[model samples]
Structures are given as C-alpha cells and as structure tokens.
Target: MSATVSPDQLPLQRLYHWERTAPNRVAFTQPVGGGQTVDYTWKQVVDQARRMAAHLQAQGIGAGDKVAMLSKNTAHWMMTDYAIWMAGAISVPLYPTLAAGTIRQILEHSEAKLLFVGKLDGWLGMKPGIPEGLPCIHHPLAEADAKKSYPGWDDIVAKTAPLAGEPVRPADDLSTIMYTSGTTGAPKGVMHTFANFMAAVAAGLERIPQNEGSRMLSYLPLSHVVERALVEHGQLQTGMHVYFAESLDTFTTDMQRARPTVFFSVPRLWVKFQQAVNHKMPQKKLDTFLKIPILSGIVKKKILSTLGLDQCIFAAGGAAPMPAELLAWYSKLGLNIAEGYGMTENIGASHITTGDPDSFGTVGRPYAPVQCRIAPDNGEIQVKAPWNMLGYYKQPELSAEMFTDDGWLKTGDKGSTDAQGRLKITGRVKDLFKTSKGKYVAPAPIEDKLVMHNAVEACCVTGANLGQPLALLMINAEATAVVKNGGKAELEASLAEHLKHINETLDPHEQLDCLVITSEAWTVDNDLITPTFKVKRNRIEDMFAKNYDRWVGMRKPVVWHG
Candidate 1:
C-alpha cells in the first residue's frame, strides 16, 4: 500500500504537537567538552525558535526569502531551521566542508538574505565566502574566534520578543533549497516543499522502526538530503530524541552517550568500523569464536556494546553503494544494516532493504508511494513519488531536464530490477569508461571490492582509453602506520595479493591492470571527495588520468605513485 500524507502531519504542525503534549521531553542532547552535555526540551526548542523568528522578521526576512545555514549538525542548527520556517522564509543549507568559491557561488545564486554560521572545523577558510555586508548570525557553538565576529545567537534570542502565536506556513510552501554535493559537475539547488518532506517522512516511518523517544545520532552533515529528512524531519514526525556528536575525536564517546536506537551512516564509516574491529582481533580468529554457539552470542554482544550500537534496532547505510561483503560482515556480527538508495533530488527517500537475506546485493524495493522503473534505452533507474523535489531553484531549464516527458525523475543510475522489484544498481550511467579495446567498464563494483581489504581506505577505478583499467588507492591509517615503521615491502606484498584476487574474478576487459598507491590523500579539501566521502570521479580524472598509462607500464601488480 502507498503511503499517504495529511496536513496535520506537516513538520511545523508536529513541532506544535510536541510542544503542547511533550513540553518537558528532551528533544536534543548536545555534547560539550570534558564529557559534559546540554539538553533542550520541546518547549525550550520552540521558545527559542520563536524568538529567532521574530528577530529575522525584524531584519526584513519575509515569506520566501532565502536564509542559509553554514554549520555542522547541532541543536541550534535545528532551531535555526525552525526559525527560518516560522519567519516564512525558505532555508538554504550549505555543507560545512564546502570550499569558499563554491560557498560564494551558492550564496550568490541562492540570493540568501542572511547566513547562520554554526559549528565548523574550518571557519577561517569559509568566512571569506560570505559576501561583505551580508547579515550573519553566529550560532552558540560557532568557533570561539568566529563567534566574536558576528551577532551571537544567544544575545539576539535574549533581547528579542518571541513571535506571538503560531506562525504557520502552507503545506505547499517551499521549505528548503538543498544544494547537491556535486560529484559530476556544479551543484544544483534542489527545491523541496513542506509537503514533500512530510510525505517522505511518512513513507520512511511506515517501514523504519521509529517513534516517540526513539534515539538518533545526528553526526552526518545535516546539509545532505538524507540526514535532514531522516534525522531532522524524522525527529519532528516521531518526537524522537536527537543527539549531536561533538567532534570526530569524540565520535566514540558521543555514540556511547546517546546509545542511539536508530543509526544511519555511509559506507566509508561502516568499513572503518569493520577495520577497527579487525585491527583488534583478526577476522579469522573472530570467525573461529563465532563458530562456537555459546561464545558467538557473547562475542557479538561485546562488539556491539563497544561500538555503542547495542540498542540499535534499525541501522541503515546510504549516500553510496555498500559492498555486499561488508553487509554480510555486519550481518554476521548481529547488526543487520539495511542498504538504501536515494539522492538529493528525492529528498533521499526511495528504496531500502527489508532484511531479506536474498536482497543482499540489491538496494531493495521502493518505499511505499515511490514508483520505480528502468528506462529501456539507457537502463537508467527512474522514480516517481509524492516526495520528489519541486524543481531546481531558479534553474528552470535544468529542472525541466531532470524529469522525463512522463514526469519521472531521472536518477542517472543504470540498474536492473529483480522479479520482486528490488533494484541492483550496476553503476552510474556517466561513470562508465571505455578502454582502448572498446569495451566499456563500470568502476563502482570493482571499487567496492578493492575497499574490502583493511589496508585500503579509498580507491577509484579508471583507465579510459587504456588497454585495461587501473585503480588509485589511498591506504588507511593502519597501513600508513605500518609503512612508517619500515613495513612498506610487507604492505606492498599484501596489496599485490589483494589486487590479484580481485582481478581473477573480473572479466578480461574489466580486470584492473594494476593498483597504484597514491601518496596524496583524497579529501574534501582537495576536491577529490564529497563531504559524504564519495569520490569525485571527474576530479579523479583531472588529477590522475595522466598517470594511468605510466602506472600500467610499470608491469607490476602494485605500483607506488609518488
């Protein structure tokens, strides 16, 4: 059965519902230094948002004005979004890790009336992007130095009168303009309405186990569509308790504090967790212990407790394709991570696995109310749903191009559907590269295999116009530590063996020629990866395509690139 949405289910309506019925319920838990934390109740959240909304109105922010937020996920981030909506303005969220040039482009293109700068790692680098004379407010958690440079959040809230009465927006009113984390080209602003977000949340709640008091950890950048919809909108719709992670260094500590019942993460972090576990105990030894029925239960409980996922009733992985091997590994550890598929255009609500063992490789069936199909000509996956974005902001022509003549959103991913309607994404339509032998190769599947080894952190498979494809690999922390301790040769041998094993399973044309260990790291700062840790294939081509032939010519299974 398809999911249905009602006007009462709107985000603001839900916020009002909780404020009246569950005023004392803890809405957010924010970690401070020295193992300290701060909590906000439903009434407190609404009260502060009301004050901020009045302040915004006083500043001339009216209906449809774009108010952008530049910060990591925090309680104030949520409060700021509510304030923007309450003031009848559309919210624009920028990824905290964006480059200054990109930030300027979005702010300029969005015509944002104001920017709210909150928690950030590189505020100094991002500060220059805000246009001069542009009104700005620094959140309570903004960097100490940056906090002094702008109007503080607390001061404004303290002095301003709370906006009287509940200021409601229409369900059709535009809620947010989410900029895509560009992997192929320049980012596009995806426009979503309040109704659209509510519909997506309605569909999600139909399947995912979430309700009032369901705990969630909001560490993924809320700028992303999935995190915003699932973590923010999910919390509103269900009155769930949301917790914020302080920093990367305190991620484990933060997880323990929240002990979230609902968790979502990308493929990279899942692999890292696996690596961390293997680093402590060899996988083979763990497998041996798992064979003992009595010991297996004890072992799994201990592992889950250590990772703070002991209470995780529903764990999901998205933003990128998850390795099937990784899924099996987590399943073996008693944590069934349901892999889902979606994008910024869909509010990141589309398909998700439902714990079917046979659905391991596929992303599973479309959510209730989401219709999916494969295009006959290109095999690109297409979807139609109530939650689909209204259109791209201000880019009418491009927005029109994103849909089919029949109105389905073109996902640009090539995949086949199983008999039961599950989707198995083969690769992106634009990510395919033709070799000198004229056979086109898809890199995502091969790249997934390469990351299964604990030594490899991130890798890209590309060798367009070359006889065979080759991979650019960046070793993980453990491998780097090992190499620094005069174990480079041992690591090289291990990589060579891993490379050969992967190549043997591929078709002749799809087989990789060699694995090049890159000296430079692929990072968000380098424009080599998106904030979500998905590699930018176009950027990879620009940076390393010239070295493909040279590495292949070395005639070794593994080649170190300086």
Candidate 2:
C-alpha cells in the first residue's frame, strides 16, 4: 500500500474523477415503483451530490459543521454523504433501528446543524425523537418523513445550482463522526479523517480484489464502519456499482437483481440463511446428496442461486465471531464465508480471512503496514495502523486511554495470534466471567459452539459469581413453534443430548452446568441484542441474574422450560 496518499485519492475526488472518466457508467441502482428499479449513472450521482452541497452552503452549513443522516440504506443516503463532505462538513449517521432516546442523545451530543431524513421504516415513530428546533431535509423516497413539512429533495435540487470547486479538504480534515452502538456501555463518538478513510480503502483494496464494474449490494447500515468503508468508500475508490435493498421483504429479490460479485452480511443473517436452506432440505439428506459426484455439483449451484449468491466472488461475515461449524457447513456447499475482525476505532481495518479453507475460524493477518500484537498481561489485541481513528470526539481523557503510551490502539477484544498470524478471538476482556472456583471463562467461544445446534437461535453463558457456568438458550421461532405443539418433550430431550455433547468437548471449568430454555426472543428493540445482532452479554446476565442461583443449584444437567 502507498505510504503517502494525495487528496485526489479521497472519496470526493474519486467521485469527480469517475464522472469525468466514465460519465454514463451506472453508479447506483435503487428499487422503485414497487418491483421496478431506477439506475443513477456516475454523472447523475456527481450532479445530485453537487446540487445538495450547494443547497447546504446556501443554508449556511459549511466547513466543519456537523450534519446528521437518519435513515435506512438508500441511494439518497449515499448522495447526501458525498454532499456533506463536498460542502466541507462532517457527516453523522444514526442507525434506523435506534430508539428515540438514542437519536436525541446523538443529535444533541454531536450538535448537528441539519438532518437528512430518508427511507426509514419507522420515521413516524421516530419523529418524536427529533429535536423540535432542528431543521430537516427529506429524501425523495422518504414518503413517511415527507408527510411532515420538511424541505424536499427536488425543491433543493431545483432551486440551487451545483457547487463549483475542486477538492477543498486536506488529508487530515474530519469527514465523519460515527457513534458506536452501545452494546457494552454508552456509545462514544468516533472521529475519522479523510486520510484515515483513504488509507483504509487503499489497504483493503490491496487485499480484497475489487475494481471498476465490480458489483455490491448495500443492505447493511451505511452508518457502521464496515459498510461505510466497503460500500461507500470502496465504491468511490474502485468505481463499483452499488444496489440498494428496498426492504427486508425484497432483500432476496434485490440480491438476485444485483447479482453482486462481492457480498457481506452479519453472522446472524448467515444463520437465518442456513436455517432457510435446512428447512427446505434436511441437513442429513443434503449431506447425503452432496456426497454424490454430479449431484453435489448440481446441488451447490442450485443452493447458491436460490439464495442469490450464485455470482458472489467474495462473501464475508463480521461484526461478531462466526461459528467454525457454520463456516464448514457453507464450505461444503461451495460458499466460503470469510470471517473478519475490526472495530469502529480503526475504520474497520484489522484482519480478514484469506478466503482459504484452512483460514476458517480465524480473522487472518493484518493489512499491509498494519501491526498487531496481543498484550502480554491480559491477552488483549492491540493494533497500530494509519487508518486508526484520530480520537473520540471531545473526550480527551477517554481518547488517551484508548491507546498505549507508544500509540498502539488498544482493542478491548481478547485474542491470540496463531503460528501463521491469524487472529482467534476469545471474547471481550470485560465480558470474561470468574466462577466461584476461581477459573476465568470466556463465554463467546462456548456460546458459538452451543448455537451450532439446529434448535438454538441465541445462547448466552453467564455465571460470574456462581459455582459453574449456565447457558441461557433462546429457541428459534420455527423450533419454538414445534415445541408449542406435541414436540415439547422431544425438543427438550434433543437439547439435553446436544448440551451433553457440547460439554464433553469443553474443559471442566468451561463446561456449562445447566441449560435454561426460554421462549422469549431477544431483539435490538428489547435491548437484548445490538443492531448488528450481537447478543449483549451484560444485558442478558442482568435479565436472569436473580434466577442464576436457583438454576445452578438445581444440580440437573438440563433445567428445562424456563
């Protein structure tokens, strides 16, 4: 990777370059008119972005001002992001799934001067969260938010002329202030500069092969660093065509339409895809068919096409650890899901699998010019990279604590490097629990193992001060429905057998003493899981803390029906 990058390498400059070099090349595709779609060329994207930038400038929102974007992933969201940077402002993104309280806190904390609302599912419900005095701009596709008397997209574009200028930002200029999802604690504002994003995009492109004409589907929240880097910055750098998912109902259809060469998703979605396949064809039967020569080839093609992954060159799972069993299952069907590791602090630059079968269960080696080490005392992973964040916004003390005296950013995840430099994440350093027997247990790896069972949807291992660790199991909806019928006894028996199998493979200290089955579902709305679908261990522990003693004292291998 290049040690020194010019301003021309930044996203805004790349957008202008693409417009001049490939004016008519399709830049984005948005679903519209129910099932139809609309395409935006490179020229169109640049023109609209410039128009929006001019509008912002007319509104006295310029250089160093903060602008917030609240919406689901959409074409307008990308356009507005570019406009904010083009207007010499910082973009602040809020997840569409965020609660009203969170929205208010972020807006007030970032001191945003304007908000661009677009393509949200629950805009009416979230309306109460928006500050009364703040001004708003509605995207063309934001029907729900359009019901209010906010400035509309067409009005802004029609009344303002395109901003006329070359790139105005230096490499160190702040581009965005991204709020971290508060899984463990209150969210912090992570600031990333133009240089940081450029460095990360350049480093990532060196490892992951993407170029002009490469296609990607943008369904994940653009707010997250992973999607922002890969879809937004990656598109600008590589001139890739991006497609937007209209809704959850149309995700499969949209994926089929784009036929993206590179696809990415969280582990939770991958699990749901796996379950969908297994529901159609029993695992045993699928395994038997895959053992046959010609039939195996046909089965693999059919499965990939059915899931709209037939054209996928690189598929990734991140934001949480993916089970080794899940990886192997996909590998058998010719889809190698590369597991990666990174955090918002680093602009999602850390480790990624080599797409090799042997690289399974490990987030592979660091990118070029990036260095990583495990802290000796607590086994916490630490990294030093050009793409690391400038600092937490307005939190000097916290920012200082995030890095070592020598400047290596301290990642709170506990992990160790293999002989080949692959990273094996154990768990969060703060999430480690100590049993009454004085043994420390990392629940993440064990929980990953438990969820491999077909009946399990989510699992949490907690016994911070108890004699032995206990597993809280949330059954999948389909499995729960089965249990509701006459399958209750049978499902309990099977879960017990599965628990015994899992415990046999674990160390005695790490073994789960009992399993508590609950029918209640954990979701982002309920605070049991983060927006990225990672289970909040602390929240789960707190929810069942009062019953932990009794559950452990039962002295039974399976404490069924909680």
Candidate 3:
C-alpha cells in the first residue's frame, strides 16, 4: 500500500540496490551433476550483468535497439536478459522449438542485430536457417563450461569491465516485445514498457505478497510474458532466489531439488500435477478415504511432501482458466493453488485470489489500481490498468482497435460480477455458439464440467447448426481399460448407462446430445494445443467437421481420432 516509488530510479538501479543490500545472498540456482547445485549470489549476478551490458554497448547496441534471446531456462538466459535492460535495449525472446521461418520473420521484424542461441537441439542443424555470420552466440545445454564456439557467455563477461553510470531509463521506454503463438495468423510483436512491468509487480504484490526471502523455481520459457513478469521481474523487485529445472523430463526431480516456497504454474502443469497424484493413488480409493477426517490428513501430508509443496504459502495457476476440481483436490491437502487470470496485454497479474473459499470459481477481485467493468455489449469484461501495454509493436491500426475512445482496453472476454464485486469469466465473446433450438450456448462451462468426470481426460464442448449438443472427448486411459476389459456389447451398454446417469444431473438443454471418444492425444507437435496446453477449439472443430453427423446422432462415446 506504500506508494513511495522514487521518480528518478531506473529498473536496473532498483535491482542493483537490492543486490547491494544482499550481496552474499544466493540469487539463482541451476541443477548440476551428482544432485549438486550451481548457485549465483546477488553481487555476482549484478557484476556479471554490468560487464555483459558493457559487451553489448561496445558493439553499438543502444537505447531502443532490439536484442533477441533464443534459449531455454538457464543461468545464461537470465544474465543476457538483464544485460539487455542494463544497456537500454528492448528484449525480444524466441522459443527454442519454433520454426526457423518464424524465427527469421521475428528477427527481421524486430530488426534484432544480435542473437543468443543456447543449448541447441542436435536435430536442428547448427546453421539451419540462420544467415551465416549473423553475430550469433551458441551455448550448448549439455556443455558445462562456456566455450570458444560463441564467446562462452561467462568468459566474455569475465574479461570486460563493468559499465557504470547513472541509470537513464524512463518508465515509458520499451522493455520487452513478446510474440503471440500466431494461432490466428502470423505472430505480431506485442510491446511493453518499464511502467508496464513495474505496475504489474505492484498489482501482483497486492494479490499475492512476496518478500526478500521468498524462494522460487524457474521452469517455464522466459520467452513467455507470464513467467518473465511473475518470476524474473519479481525476483528483481524483492531479491528472491530463483532456481531452474533441468528440462521437461526432469521436472519432478527438479521440484524436489528446489522445494520452492513460492510456486507458479500454467493450467496445463496444474492438470499434470493432479494427474500425477491420481496416478499414484486411484481416484475412487482416494475419495472414499478422504471422507474420514483423520485419514485424510495423512493422505494430504503424504501427497504434499511428495510434491515438494509441504512448506509453500501459495501455489498459483494461470495463463488459462483451471478446472475447479483440481484446486479443491489440492486445497484438501493443505496446498492452496489459487487460479489467476490475466492476458499478456495486462502485464500478467490482473486478478487473483487471496484465500476465502467462496471465491473459487472467480479469479478474484481487481489487483491494486486495476479496474474492471462488465461491458454493456454482451457483458464482455473491460479493463483499465496502468500496466496495460503501449500497443502492439509497430501496428498502429490494430493497436487502435484494442482500446476504446475513452481509454478502456476491450478485454474480448465475457463474464459477470458477483454481488461481492468479484469477477467470474464465463467465456470468450467469440466462442459462444447458437444451437438449432435458437438458444445461445457457452461451451466453456460445459467443457469444464465434462472434464471433471472420471472417464474424461479432456473434452471440447461445441454445438453448431445440426446439433442438439456435442462433445469431443479424450477419455482417461484407466477408463478406457475398464471399457476394454468388458466385452464389446457390454462395454457399449455400460457406457450408454453412464451417459444416462450423467444426463440425469444436467438440465434438458445442458445434457450432451452426442459424444465422440478419441484415443489420440493433442500435443504441441500436432499444432492442436498451445504451449500452455489449451486446445485450439477452432482447429479441433475443423478436424471433426466431416463427421458432424455421427457426433449429433450418437448416444454413446465414439472413437473419432483413431
């Protein structure tokens, strides 16, 4: 609640102040061999960053010049990000797995003159699409020491002198420009300023408090704005120590290593965590045991200790709405993983829960100066925040469309405000559908409901022209096993009975009129799911359009993906 920001300090200046106050305190950690740790102190990070800044500035990089970082979550990645800001360059981040075509386009679009590629995937040739001699730096992930191939990130810093001067950043200077996944079209650069990041930190503090002693893990792509804003920037603000996981495969072991006091994750990861717990203890037995209070405590503690969350204050899920059941399950075990809601335009922390069980479905009230209103047209959420972006990088027309004449950002999301003034987002305005019965249907709530059933892995609820109701589903492997164990005729009969049981609980219109089962998974490789694992409904609907008739007429789940 203290609004005492000094008017003249640049971001680097503020960050340096924290490092000075805690010079010997650990600032970051990364995994090493033999279950050992690789750590960086605050002073070391600041000194190295200054030298890296000197390296970039000596190469003629200056204020507003774009610098792109292409790497995974590692110590070098963070060092390079700080150096970009310390030297007053706008940072552009590229996903390591992205298409070379997309990489080329972003590089050309941002006019990024210097590139840093880390821990290269061997499958993608060393010089696949990159123009030869592009002043590129490469750090193989497996290499323990920075090498001569690309000015081993550390040796270059060790040789250079730290640049020193008064900080010159203004709140309005462009800080970072992150690219969208381009599901709708080619990716456009989304811009943010120093004020955007600072305001986000302020808003986030109001919802979820972090202090100098907070310990966190860094696993998500720093290329993404959410993790960058919450974990990276938050660390700069409070001097919290950050740790990085080895890779996607090592997430479990890495969590055990970090034992983070503060955890943040996307919905996809939240679902996976729940799946992990369920995999260890089957749902039916776990649920039946939870009814007895004393036994439930034993179960909850065992699960929490195993997940390395036995001492966490809060674990948060964001980037997409979470299935409510997941939160309740973890909450029962004394793990409070609250859901947060915000988009890239809002600097990542817009609304979040601060306990109070009744607010489960909502992403909570506004954080700090952020204001929201249910827009008069179709009840889409409208917001105004100091943290809102300057606009899309170089796209004035699209930027103009994003804001109204009066300055509110049209959120493009539909929701309602409860009497308590908390917001509950119902669906995206563009996602609603009209059934043949002349009634409007919101598929999101239905999808959320269907996925809660034990048989479902994930489901897409959509109904167009010919349908009463339709759901495309990927059922759980355990459920599939149950069906296969029974004879064919018996499997069909039992599944039909299950549908009747589920329909009895739904209103006549809400009942699913058709269901299609699929054995195949939707993953990043197939272009069906986002990095955060939300299914692209438009693409899924298009894939199943030819068999719309079968979906509408069926009474039991049908295998469509096979």
Candidate 4:
C-alpha cells in the first residue's frame, strides 16, 4: 500500500490531461511591465510548449540532445522545460545567479546543443559564458540579451506549427540534468528521469495537501529541485494556479496578489521575515500583546495578512536547516514553518516536519516508500527512494561512490533519528571540523543558534586545528546602520551577551571561542553563498584561515570587528 503514482502518470502526461480536461483553467499568472499581470490557461501552456517543441525539432535537436536554459523564474521558463522534454531532449538548468565561469563550465560539461535565455538579471555579464558555437534562442522577456542577433522565442512560436503529438519517452528516460550549487566543492550534474520526478511528485502530493484550486507563489529559482517539485510538478499534479514574483522589489506585493495556499521558502528568507516583524514590533512588546487572548488573534491575523501568508494552509522551510527558536516564534503567530530535508540528488524528496508542535525541530518521518537510515559509523544519512537521481551525469566513478553496494544513495549529511523516526540533521559530513583538542564540532547547530540573534544576519562556525571553534558573523544591514549612527558600543555589548548565551547552551567542545564580526557581507555576488542561499563553507574557510589563529588567540568572547 503505497501512495506513489505510476510512471505513466508523469508530469508531462498530466499536463496534457489537464489541458484536455480544463483547457480554460488558469495555469499560470505572470507579471509583465508596469503593475500588471497576465494569465495563461492550461491550453495556452500546451500550445506554447507544443510550438516550442516543434521549433526545437525543426532545428534538428532530437531525442537525447541536451538543451540548456539560463533564466530567472517565469512562465516561459517552465514552458521551455516542457518543450525540451516534449522534443525528446534533456533539459539543463543554470541558476541566474551563477558567474560566467560556472555558467560556461555547466554548459560545456552538459554538452548542451541549444541554449535558451530568458528574463535574466545578469544576462549581459553571462553572455560571454555561452559557448561560441552553440545556437541560442532568446525569450521575449530577454530583450536586452536578444539584441545579440539570436532568433527570438516569439518568432519561433509564430513561424512553427504545434507539434502533432507529444513525443513518447520511457519512464527511465532522462528528463533533466541539474547541476549542484556546490557549497563544499565543485558542482556535479545530477541526472533525474521522468520516473524519478513522478515518484517525487506523487510522494510530495500525498504528504502536502493540494487540489485544483490550490495556489503557489514561484519565486525560488525553478532550477532548484524543491521549486521544481513543489511548484512546477505540483502545478501539473493538482492543476494549481501559479504566480511568479516579478523581482525582489515586488515580492511582497506579488505574494499578496497570489495569496498562496501552499508556500515554501528557504531558511534565510524566513529569518529576514522574522527580523522584519521584530523590527516593527519589538519581541517583548509582541509577547505582551499575545498574552491578551483577544489581541493575540488580531495580532496574528494582521501579521500573517501583511506578509501575505494569511491563506497559507502549509508553510515549509527547506534548502537549509531552520533555527528552532525561529520555528517556535512563528508558531506563536499560529504559522508553523515546518522544516523538510532533501538534496538535489534525491529530487528534494525525503523528510518533512509534521505540523504538530512536538515535531518542530525535527524533519519528520520519511515519505511513503522512501527509506532513510543513518550510517552506523559516521552518522551520515542514507536514503533509498524511487525519486533518487540515476547518477551524476558523465562521472561514472563519482556516481559509483555515491551509493553503497546495496544501493542506498549516500546523502553525505550527518543526522540521527528520534524515537518517532523523525530525522534531525546535525551537519554535513564534510562540514564537521576537528578542534586542536581532537573533538569534532558540527557547525550547523551552532550557526543556527548564532543566527537567532536579530543583529546576526549570516554566520559560519570554523576553527579547524584551533583550541575551539569560532563564529564568523555578519551583522544585519539595518543593525550595522544603527551601529554606524553612534550605536557601536551598545551593539558590541549586545553581541557579546548573545555569544555568552549561545555558548552556555553548547557542549564544551562545540562552544565557540570567539565571534569574529566580519565587515563585508557574504553574498552570492562575492561567492560567499550559493544561489540557494547556503553559505559557502569552503570559501569562508579560505578567506579566514590565515586570521583564524590570531582571532582565537585573542581569547575574547567576541571580536567586535574584523
């Protein structure tokens, strides 16, 4: 008795089924110039995908050929993905935030025969990364990049007829080759098939409730597996109406317009949201207001509505571990931000937190037919699921090493299971560092605790070969501005107190020796964070390795400045 759907019920087939059954139903609502939005029906999606598929076929791109898409999230992005598959080609997605070098590497490594550019913020900078011989197609939204003399996407759609019939692909046929945004090391392309996607979509739908009228806001890069599973595939499965965020500036207004019934976000964005609420209503004052039963309901409703999460039936946080304190705080507002655990290799399928209060800190039990177990030796979590990727594309040796002889995909994450079978991730196996005292320190939990402080925007704990670990902290922009305006001493003292509080709760070995407050913020532009918002631990270590000895030797509880 499993909830998993058969491969025959794949997303592409489901798309066609919905097109036939609900052709007029709104499939996507995309924002255009000005403050306007455009709606596309299921029929429109199929029509566009069909025409695009025909165009690809006309260009001699056939089955097994690789097609790459570099773009931000948009209706066209999803349509292009479908068209690639419909044309019997493998789709390769590149994150819009990637630098030209990484972009070039992925495109070359994947052997992409054709490239589609759409709605990118950095297309001008990334244009040089396109391999010279590869043909390019520019979406209408990519007008800036389109000036380079590539054929327009609209031109293809207008000139080509719709594909006569959907191309047949076996369940095991490769659907997409997704490159991992390497936080620890070099990126590797993870290959997933139509069957893998179907399995993930089926398991995810069973765990998270969704139906025809469900709404989702798609802002996270569709290149990521979580957005693909939850937003794209979720749309196909449930006939959900999707709304795309126009840009970072319009995210709030867009969220309000969508009023999404199911919302998902990474932990960094969730932390910012919490910090914003705290700025408006100080934590102490909010706590006092919540004590009044009548006022509590009003405060909660007002806060949720303003954040445009008032209609959210399910709110999930993933791509990184969420701080337990943040989860508790959201719970007080009657919005439980459940944490889920997965990686690109598994098509983002694994554990998800139950809405129950007791399950707050742990990623809940495995989804149906997905097995999870911790390695007895190093505590790495291993998974066996129908949704797991076939292997790392073009790296047979690396692929072979990803699984045990018995076939569980080695997740490379360190975690443990509770009595209720809930999984609590400690850190990545490669992320654990050893102190001079020979004790191993897992930075994730400690970093989570440090980021709970409102002033601390991002944090990394590293002290390899030192007496104890030290936290490299970045102050929030607002907090830094306050310090610049004569609040320096107060901010330092507050940070010191925060460090002491965090240290007291940690094990002796895990306690941070000092907090090094970094001047420059870590960001994707600077290569300090991945596109998915996970901190690049390797880069941080490289930047501070020389200063680590000096910082730890200072023997102060907090460095105040670095």
Residue 244 in candidate 2, Cα distance off native in Å: 0.7
- Best-to-worst order by lDDT is 1, 4, 2, 3
Candidate 1 residue lDDT tens string, 95-153: 99999999999999999999999999989998889899899999998998778889999
Ranking by TM-score: 1, 4, 2, 3
- Per-residue CA lDDT of candidate 2, range 1-562, in tens? 2235787898778988998999999999999757989999989988899999988988999998999999889889999999999998999999888888889989998999999988877777777889988999999888654547698987889878998876567788899999999678877999998888888889889877788968999999999999999999999999999999988888789889989899989987898899989989999999999999999999999999989999898899899899989999999999888887899999888989976789987899998878999999999999998888888888899999999999999999999889998998989999898999999999998988888888888888899878889999888988988877879878878888988998899999998889998656898778898888878888987788898888788887767645
Candidate number with greatest TM-score: 1
Quickly count the clashes in candidate 2.
0
The digit string of per-residue lDDT tens for model 4 on 1-562 reads 1124565488788888888899999899999979999999999989999999998998999999999999899999999999998999999999988888888999999999999999888677888898898999988778574646688888889888999865667778898999999797778999998888888888888889878889999999999999988898888888989999999999889999999999999988999999989999999999999999999999999999999999999999999998888899999999987788899999888999876679977898998888999999999999988777888999999999999989898988999999989998989999888999999999998999999989988899998888888999988888999988999888888889998998999999888888888998888888999998889988998888899888877788778554
The candidate, 1 or 4, that scores higher on TM-score is 1
Candidate 1 whole-model C-alpha lDDT, 0 to 1: 0.92
Which pairs clash in the backbone of model 1? none
Candidate 1 segments exceeding 4 Å error: 1-4
Candidate 1 TM-score, true structure as reference: 0.99
Candidate 2 residue pairs in clash (backbone atoms < 3 Å): none
lDDT preference between candidates 1 and 3, better one: 1
Per-residue lDDT of model 3, residues 1-562, tens digit only: 1122444334676667866688898888977546667888878888888888898999999998999887778777887888889898998987666667777888888889788877544325334555556676554353432244466665677699997864557777788899866445577788987777876786686666677888888888788788888788888777787888887677778888778888988765666677778877888888987889999889888887888787688789877777676778777777777778888777666788764567788888888788888888689888888878778888899889988888888877899988988889899888888777776777777776666655666678777665466778776666677667865455455555656666777767767776677667766456566655667788887787787776566544544446
Question: What's the lDDT for all of these models?
Answer: 0.92, 0.88, 0.74, 0.89
